[model samples]
Target: MIQHGLPTIDQAWTAQQLERNLSRVLNTGVCNKVLDALKSPNADFQVIAEMLKGDPYVATRVVGIANMVRRRDGVAIQSIQRAVQVLGLRQVSNLMLSVMLTGPLLSAEGQLPRRKDLWRWVIACGVANNYIASQLGQQTDDNPDHLVGGLILGLGAIVLWAGLGQAYHRVLGARLRPMSLNRREMMDLNVIHTQVSLWTLEAMGCPDVMGEGLRALLAGGRDETYLRYRCVEVLGARIAGLDASDASAWLADGLPRLGIDQKHVENDLGVLRSELRQIGKIFEVDLGSWESQQAFHQKIMVESGQALASLIIDHLTMQESLGISES
Candidate 1:
């Protein structure tokens, strides 16, 4: 696996400090074992299934993806080994990584509903990114399953919340600002969550492609892989009904040289959405979780104005304390 570390001088928290914080927050005992097994050359379907059996979420999600892929028209796939066979090794690994990170962080407690909303957005993004990759793969006759980019999109937010706890909540709760989420975190926490997420993924021993895909999703480039990553990632949150104007601004720049447009997105995702629904039914995973996301956004608009005003004040005070020049 390729390792990418942040330049130490720019970081508010040193790399070691970030790791120490993440270690306390993420329950990686079972996760490390599972990922290790996934990476082992000797690991087979049965061996992988055995490793995952220890974690309820991983096991259930594995079966869910298997049945989701199967479409449930023939028969339900309940056995772990059978599930692995249906998904193939690579897809199963992708699904497992998707479930583990998204499952834990998005499950955090809150009346703010940010965690729940992020959960919905992240999962839907997994669906959307996979759809876009599949489209590109067909034309080039390459593997079409670039699913991890969408799931990793929220890694920075998840870690910020997990590591900083309520402190991160205050940052996100503040009224919508024109700044990118990265800038917001940099001002307050002296580190970018996406970078934290990238570092965390590297620390966790993720493959080079995942790390590369994340970078592409963040800054974008004209490389085919980067373009595919950007296509779904830039639009995933918007389509998922999350606030992501900062990320979506790329579509207008023509910097990445992407060709797909709004109509293309709606039409393509429409078909993929049906398949996502089928996976939800088969695996009971709620992969296409927009059912409640739209309603959540509506509720936030009506209920959050005054509350956000208070958070904005809190954020300004925090910036003052840290001497983050707002000029």
Candidate 2:
């Protein structure tokens, strides 16, 4: 069993045991078949990819890959065949298998709060991540994996939302977000989801380097991984076009934990906003649509609150038990 800050588990919540059970499930033959299909020949890519997409676990990965390949390769590609060519057979297979294995990480009995806003943020983050990758020259115009790191960045929150049921709602309502809350409050709200999601991803066969890099990025440290850099890039973009002081304040107070300096952050924010405008033009969406953007930010706050509430409850139980033992 894994030991969190809480006291030893009463024989039921060991990390080792959870890891063993999850590992076995992930290694099963059916899971392997799903992964194999993700790597199938182009003639079979669309059918299999679509089938995989039907599973919630695989949907983001499929979409991420398709987007990466199309954007980087610039091959005027419209199908999965082009995606595979852009991303290559190996990377696609790894992502597909990884997606299938992540299925069991979220418990089945929990109910999530608002999902629409969370999904929109996830998609936005993914888009922002890809744009950063493009700017960094990590991929050409056709590859989709460029944003793979960003799409699943919030998996930890999703896992918590899936695990805590209603306890999450009550606690998040009581604490964590009260208006103009600090970044520490957000972290306090989300730390459990962050840890559990990372552990779950590790157990599901993600390369430790990638998983750890992402964890570090979210946890806010000055790490040097590609994922970390990209996270900073996306975050900077999220608040771009706002007052420079406001954006800088977010960096000064909240984002430094992710290891980016304010100067670089401001610079990246400019680049990303410009790039986003271009992307918006391509998609025919108005990047500077003030009313819509305000609505979107409001929605993100509402949903992020729910996600935070779920995470807080999971950790609070641990904290509560520890407190009782200490008292």
Candidate 3:
């Protein structure tokens, strides 16, 4: 059994341990087959359709999403092959990856607090990232692969939570802001989620573009492409009721870098949000009604405050146990 504990910053994560944790999370052979299919050059409709047919649940989801895409027509897509054709290889791949990544978490017995919220945030980021890419008129290397990339980025957090189990829950309950989690995670685990995410993707044989996009998003440097993706991710997190404040600074710095004005970015984001809601339906993610959004926002604020108080208590208890004085 894997031991769960908060490690000091000096503790290093070994390659063997990383592989063991990744295996624990992705134990199924079907997931491996799907990942293999994703990296293949000839990942055409037939290849994906055949692979998806092996898993009834995943196939049903693909058909469901395909039908959702054809909304208002009332047409039933009963065939997985037809569904693949309707959604195209890129989109079909996106849906497949989303299922593979989230299936284990969904079926797990012990529920992680706010796991649904994290998933909702994941779907939003995936959809929003693709939408932002479209708005920019830039063709992504893998087309709609940004959707998968966004989901994989969110998976990093899930991996940490699930791998560390209860100890990680303590970290989550502390309710650090989304961006702040990076620093806190580094201080506690000696490795950030982005690094964990990259390692998992590489270990799983994910495509280069996924790793590239993640690296760019995490390391917000002068790269224009990286900044664009970072902006989209930040916008998606805000929509999911995570952290909205961090995006403003990114936008302030990024828009000028892209040679675009604030009005254009705002207009694009407005259109993107509407598109996101429609896309959210296909992904089955509830970004919430306006009232719900407000309620969620309030809940997050309250929880953050409560978590900070709890953290103070935890810290004082630890200090006292270590014989440290308040001074």
lDDT of each: 0.53, 0.42, 0.57
Candidate 3 clash total? 0
Q: Which tens-of-lDDT digit does each residue in 127-154 have in candidate 2?
A: 5666545545567354445445554564
Q: Which order, best to worst by lDDT?
A: 3, 1, 2
List where candidate 2 sits over 4 angstroms from the true fold.
1-31, 36-68, 71-83, 94-112, 170-191, 215-220, 223-248, 252-327
Q: After superposition, which runs of candidate 1 have C-alpha atoms over 4 Å from their true positions?
A: 1-31, 72-74, 106-112, 138-145, 174-179, 217-228, 244-256, 269-327
lDDT of 3 by residue, 89-150 (tens): 76776666666565434443365575645555666677667656665775643345666766
What is the C-alpha lDDT profile of model 1 across 202-229, one tens digit per residue? Answer: 6556677777766765574577666666
How far in Å is the alpha carbon of 208 misplaced in model 3? 1.9
Candidate 3: lDDT of 164? 65
Worst 10 residues of 2 by lDDT: 318-327
TM-score of 1: 0.66
Determine which window of 10 residues in candidate 3 has minimal summed lDDT.
317-326
- Kindly provide the TM-score of model 3 when superposed on the true structure, using C-alpha atoms: 0.67
TM-score of each: 0.66, 0.50, 0.67
